[model samples]
Target chain A: MSAAGRTVRPVSIASFAQSQNVRKDNERNEAEGLQPVIAEVFANVGITKDDVDFICSGSTDYLIGGPFSFVMALDAVGVWPPRAESHVEMDGAWALYEAWVLFQEGEIDAALVYAFGRSSLGDLNEILTLQLDPYYEAPLWPDIVSLNALQARAMIDAGKATEADFAAIASRSRRDALSNPKAQVRHDVAPDVLLEDDYVVAPLRRHALPPITDGAAAIVLAAGDKALQWSERPVWITGFDHRMETHSLGARDLTVSPSTAKAAEVAGVADGNVDIAEIHAPFAHQELIIAEALGLDDSVAVNPSGGPLAANPLMSAGLIRIGEAASRIRAGQADRAVAHATSGPCLQQNLVCVLEGA
Target chain B: MAERCAVIGVGQTHHKAKREDVSIAGLVREAAKMALADADLTWSDIDAVVIGKAPDMFEGNMMPEIYLAPALGAVGKPMFRVHTAGSVGGSTAIVAAHLISSGIHKRVLTVAYEKQSDSDAMWALSVPQPFAAPLLAGAGGYFAPHIRAYMRRSGAPDHIGRMVAVKDRKNAMRNPYAHLHLADIDMKMVEESMMLWDPLRYLEACPSSDGAAAMVLAAEDAVSGHYPPAWVHGMAMRSEPTMFAGRDQINPQAGRDCSADVYAQAGVTDPRAQFDCAEVYVPFSWYEPMWLENLGFCGQGDGWKLTEAGATAFDGDIPWNASGGVLSSNPIGASGMLRFLEVAMQVRGQAGEHQVDGAKLALGQAYGGGSQFFSMWVVGSAKP
Candidate 1:
């Protein structure tokens, strides 16, 4: 396989906890908001910060309008005696991937992966616009909603999907989110009613847009014997891989996500029956593209936790996808699941994780 | 078990205060291309790409790797970004190494850089927060007190910092890519320089530069052997709270713990004698001696004595910063990688004029976030 893709040791998501999704957590700082979530994740598995061998976090400084925001967020973990730690500027899904890779080395048995973001702190549209090509696209200040709208229009023109399809996805997600106590935008609106909503940017309507959320999420991972020790029903990560596409919007066919397709294939998503899929689709129409790329059929229940549509917390949304999928498997709601995380404009990069319960 | 990983290629940009000629993508490409050429491989040979930088604010672009992915030939391949403060560059290399050492990938390309010229780094680093203490004085003002603390505790004369400033600048003269080529640097010149912070002259601090460093790491079996590989022996990272009650800021416990973890893996004891040389992150001149104690190269309070005795010079028993180190060329993010890369270069005998003769083993250390984050690695010429 191109001299890559060697076998990795089995790692399990022992526990997962997320902060209550909210529009703005004005009362608490990033670290303070994350403390309880970290406590929950640790307490879920009956462990503490001392039990984990390493700690890694995912976040972006741009959201906080400063540099090294992740540095201060380390307080939540209470690294008193010092700990082996690292951070990623991307999403928490990648942070988990890194920890999983280290697990393959047969070094430490457990690690903590977390991500925090306060999307409400700044103009998410302007902040996300800065993520584009500086010289070519970012200068134009095409907000995130407008960029996703461009992708939606391209899909509509290709006859791959329609405005009604986008609303249907959003309608199903928010309705499912009603059961999720932590979800920010839980509702029971129907597709027809959602279609009546005015478009935020042409093809994409207000219902299709994700709520601007400020939150954090954490997942405790254990490998080998520790995985079995952590949970009575451990959700084992069977396969994990991530891929990237070129940044040029004009060069890519917006109708499909080749990166997702490649990552899904590499992660062996089709190897078993995927009973549930937790896809991080910030934009409703993008969910269709990701589902198609994952090669899932109608039988596969999607967004059981409402996905990112109901509570998209920027950096943590993708990580929450994995947490949700693993939680479903651990709760005996599913036997097999697929979790996907996306970054960059129009999903230029994507990560896929396949989980199963023994 | 983990597979062995080795450095098969290394390349870096000619550091400057402002690389106005090239775009961010173009600047990174220069180092990536050179690393590929050195490895006798093409972009297609790389299984994945791992990049690191200080912060998106430094360049005014958020996560620039997404945009520069195509430029680094990361399309259709996995690309990752690391941001662990100033130690990010070393952490980036360690992550890339793990890809091979873990047997998940054969050959991976890692790059770390900082285009500080794009934005005012001083302003970006010290941006005001709502109710927190203002760090408007930038890193120098924040660290100057720590340096002063070292002086007060160690009972070392002020000239020790001036000697380090002179030593690294002279070493930079031998290294062509170094940003500061102070051929005339001496104790007198450093002593006469403007005092940016009390007890810290302008010459004693690192210069803000635009540069990038890259390396191509491969699994043991994947190496072509065209160039003598610098085998990675051990690598580690540790972190602690920035400010804690009774924390030893002078010689951080995290740094000592990190170095101990790495040394144990590398089967190293008596670091001063076990390693031939070391490249440490010393943004300010006094950090050279401060790190000596933290890294266990010498005893606490004796690090300045080692410096004064010429124990860390090129001709000394344990030379430090033979490639000018961070003091001569600080790209913030890339500075840590340069430390790791220089040791790899030394072991490969590819350091040219700045090469330490017959260097068989060496250490590379990087710290960030008020000396709370530490990343260190040991490399050897022989297969460990």
Candidate 2:
């Protein structure tokens, strides 16, 4: 195969840790909130900072309303002698992808990946508006919820899904959250009752929206000998890839996720049996769109850990999906699984990672 | 093992104080188009695109990569964004190069840019944070004391900084794309310039400009451009804390370790003798001497001696910043990448008027955030 299309070397997720998801973490700052999570990830594998050859993080300065927020967050790692490090403004899932790419180079045996965000810091609805095209969409100050609603409405008009389906997804995800200790929203309410809730936007009820969360997550990636030493049942990342669609909403088919489909195909998510999937869909209708794009069957258990619906930490949500899927495999819940992450409005970009146990 | 990678194309915009004619997307696409044209490739040929910038607050846009995807022809392709403060530009290129080096993609395009004219950088840098003392004086005030510290430690004469200001500006006149072209730049003019931060003159500092830089990196088998490829010999990045007890701000261990790692990878026992030239991030005139010692170009405290002897001039044996560097055109986020691509230009003999004669190997370096974040690379004419 050509270098561009050839598969990448497999890397194992040795350990994962995250802070308790909350609406407002007023007590701890970014570094303070991340300190315990970073320590827990390292401690879980009985290793120190020196064990990892490289470190990478995913975060945004916009969350803190200051520049270089990642700079101060480095204090949590206590890099006294300095370390080989890099940061991405996307999300923790991309950070993991970056470290995974470096592992393929055969230069490093282990790496640490992390991400943190506090959605409670500012007006998230207004702040997210700035992510639109400054020359066109941003001038109108379109809220994120309205954009997602447009997609939901598009799905309804196409006869692909209904408001009831959105309610059903929200009901199942929140019910699953009852078992997840770190999840912020957990309930056993029925879909019919959820349908009666007031709409934050037309066709989208309050339950369909993700809860505001302040949280941090960390994952340690191990290759070769380190994988065997750290994990009893190593969950290897067999394939990983991400794709982006055009930013213009009018140019895309909002009822479907072509980016997700393309990324899933490239990551070989359907090459084998998928026992479970952890999908990062902030809105209820998105879960259905992404699941259909992934080509998953009814046999596949989706969002067993409640997914973004239960705890959608801005930059950390996508990474949490990968960690949750890897954890299920390590726990012997499934032999193979698919994890998905998304960025941009209406899932304009998507990432897919296929994991399997040895 | 990693696959060999090379820079097949490089391009930049005509830097200016304000590119009012172009939007953010227009500025970045201008550079990207030039890079693709130089490589003899189209947008479809690029498998992925990676972009980097200083901060979202600089332009009041959160993660502009999402908006820029369509403009850069990233739709239906993998798009990545990197942010590591001022060093983000260099690290951004390193990440794009790795896509090829790791054999994941045969060809990759990387871009770094800054439109500081969109907003006030000083205001963005001085925003007060809870529980931390605000940087009320902006960047210059924060670094001026460091310059004073270096002056005290090195015992270098004050005139040494004026000499560096004179040399870089004179070199800028030869580069058409440079933001500052002071035709009559000299020691007298530099001395007469008004002082901003104590011990640092206004003319001794970098000019705020709007620009972008881009490059197309390809695997060894994929290199088929019009110009010679600048082979990737070594690349590295190191970062330390912003503050700590007993930290040597003058000669940071992070900078030393970063250079040491790259030099080791390239098998350079003596950087001053091995590399033909370097494009180091000297945002202030005094930084030329300070970074000279920090980058191991000279022994401790002896960096000023090289400047005083005219060894760092355009005609000097080891010319620095032949492309004018940050001292002439600083677009914050794009400044670091200018160093990286300028070195690539040197090795490829595509530097045009500022081309260092017979340049075969060169170094590119950038640092950010209180001189803690460091990224460096060594490129050569021959493949590793």
Candidate 3:
């Protein structure tokens, strides 16, 4: 009846898989695009649909241009007599959070979490404009890039960062993304050369913008004995939490992310020394903002898997960060890692996951 | 293994085709405020908030939860958004309950709403996606064929569907909040109604309603003064692919698995004899029987027989949808939670005019997305 001394249901990411990121994936529907990724994750975990106790997914119908798009994606899983499942409209990271909650109850042993988005299917910038207040800001049609530009300008004006710093982040991301097959944006241009390029939005350059992509990612979570039996090395989630800020851009303090700072604290991000971090900051300047909010130092390797700047696939981008961080633990690359995901414009909501090798 | 959760408060808006008088924030707040009042609490008592809706396209506002946070009194608190298609309402409630059962939060407020009047649901649903077969009509078009499949499999009489339509409408007369209250509803009238989809007459289908449903869930200690809390005996959600080779759209496996899991937890070996009443999401009339089998109220291929014998009627041994259900009132996103809230209302003896007589135990169910996604819960008067 009480949480004190309650059995901590340790759940681990058993297997993870993601699709190849591309500028435009016109050949396959969301289900077809996700089928191979789901199969690969299951194959890696050596399990079938029958072995899974629950299924949860993260997606937004806005990305695919329809309502109930998640319904059609069910064709990929081929549910017959139905299976225990749930979903989050935010991102795959939150879907994994839901599955973790169920696992904590000790009722379900294993769950599959997957998410897909076709950011290139529509005018993503224009579509994202709708995320603003419909009555106030949306009428102005402030696209994501323009909004980020405002933030970037504020950071510059506040003397917290410089345009060169934003360019450097983009340069390093592209250089790092060269190693990621799933990354859609990869170029070896130097930061100085990037600064020479014309600005897409005053202080922000085109290279700083994430490539619109079509992609899918899936992860399998197993709890307690299932986690121990699934693999030799397991990536255990130590702490997970998410928080949201007010929606109106005018109502927020555009310079700082209090939500991310609070979420990181609640998730015990400072309780242990983090070796690696994967932060979801689609815009280059926001990376600087979140890295400081998370209190990550230069010693902590950030976005070794290239992060969202490499392939920002809307809803799936955040989940991919968690998967990327867990993959490092499974590969014996790090003892502890932190993965973060953001939703809504100007990072209105943030989720933090701290993973440790077990 | 987990802390027990209870539904301390339930609230919903009076469903209608259009609620143009209020803004989106006002629509959701109406339900949230009611739920808060029911729990004898204020906005400050809530620890977290979870909201769900079908799609942002329905309101032409992407992730409206961001804008709705203040209206839901979620400022400076954790807020989460869930979209599991039509079953989002049920899933949203489940997530809130989990917060309590996890012992992380004592009080969680969950809300689901859809203002369909903002846009055409049919067009929103039919938006063409790259590299996909275009759906000619809306969801009804996609589901009609499956209903036909159920008809063919069960060998059910054509009139059976009409009977369910008439029965639910008559029941709606008792539900003051139901969207479609046909005072003169009858079998003949339903049978003669225009066919929106084959086997789904206009009267048999759920209306495109603008409304919202909200619930306040609390942990055991948090419900000290809340009397007659509808204890959450069991909760489960299941899903499968929309389609695959030999996948049965009629009587989806996810719905069956979800029901089995919930009933097992609730200690109900036989839902028919154990449950005094049920509030199930049956957007179309024929689904009443289809879901009867899926939810284990009857054996496979025998669900229609329960309808034929009037066993699912309000006065029957196992009453189903005594408040007219989704067929009579459906705010797509909130329809699932409406079923859940209705079940809670029954156990709490708070269902006013539409109260099922002495309903001690009840089942609530909802399914979405090609019938692949399903969420169900069992509620009872006694604390678990």
Candidate 3's DockQ: 0.60
lDDT of 1 by residue, B3-69 (tens): 8999999989999999999999988999888888888899999999999999899989999989999
Worst 10 residues of 2 chain A by lDDT: A1-10
lDDT of each: 0.93, 0.93, 0.87
- Please provide TM-scores computed only on chain A for all of the candidate models, following their numbering: 0.98, 0.98, 0.97
Candidate 2: list runs displaced more than 4 Å.
A1-7
Reference-based lDDT, residue A13, model 3: 90
Provide the global lDDT of candidate 2 against the true structure. Answer: 0.93
Better of 2 and 3 by lDDT: 2
**Per-residue lDDT of B1-384 in model 3, one digit per residue for the tens?**
389899988888988999988888889999998888899999999989999988889889988887888889887677888988888888889888998898778899999998999888888878776566877688889889998999999999898888899889888999998999899998888878898889788998889999999999999898832448999999888777764776678877667778888988899999999999999989989999999998888888898999989999989999899999999988899999999999999999999888988998999998887777788899999977
Displacement of the residue B3 alpha carbon in candidate 1, Å: 0.6
After superposition, candidate 3 runs with Cα above 4 Å error: A1-8, B152-155, B224-227, B299-302
Taking every candidate in turn, the Cα RMSD to the unseen true structure, in Å, is 1.2, 1.1, 2.4
Instruction: Quote the lDDT for B118 in model 1.
Output: 92
Span of ten consecutive residues with least summed lDDT in model 1 chain A: A1-10
**Candidate 1 docking category?**
high
A1-358, model 1: which lDDT tens digit per residue?
1113466578999999999999999999889999999999999999999999999999999999999999889999989899999999999999999998898888779999999999999999999999999999999999999989999999999999999999999999999999999999999998999999998899889998999999999999998788999999989898899999999899999889999999888888888899999999999989999999999999999999999999999899999999999999999999999999999999889999999997
The superposed Cα distance between candidate 3 and the true structure at residue A60, in angstroms, equals 1.5
Which tens-of-lDDT digit does each residue in A1-358 have in candidate 2?
1123685677999999999999999999999999999999999999999999999999989899998999999999988898999999988999999998898888799999999999999998898998999989998999999999999999999999999999999999999999999999999999999999999999899999999999999999999999999999999999888999999999999989998998888888878999999999999999989999999999999999999999999999999999999999999999999999999999998999999999
* Candidate 1 residue spans exceeding 4 A from truth: A1-5
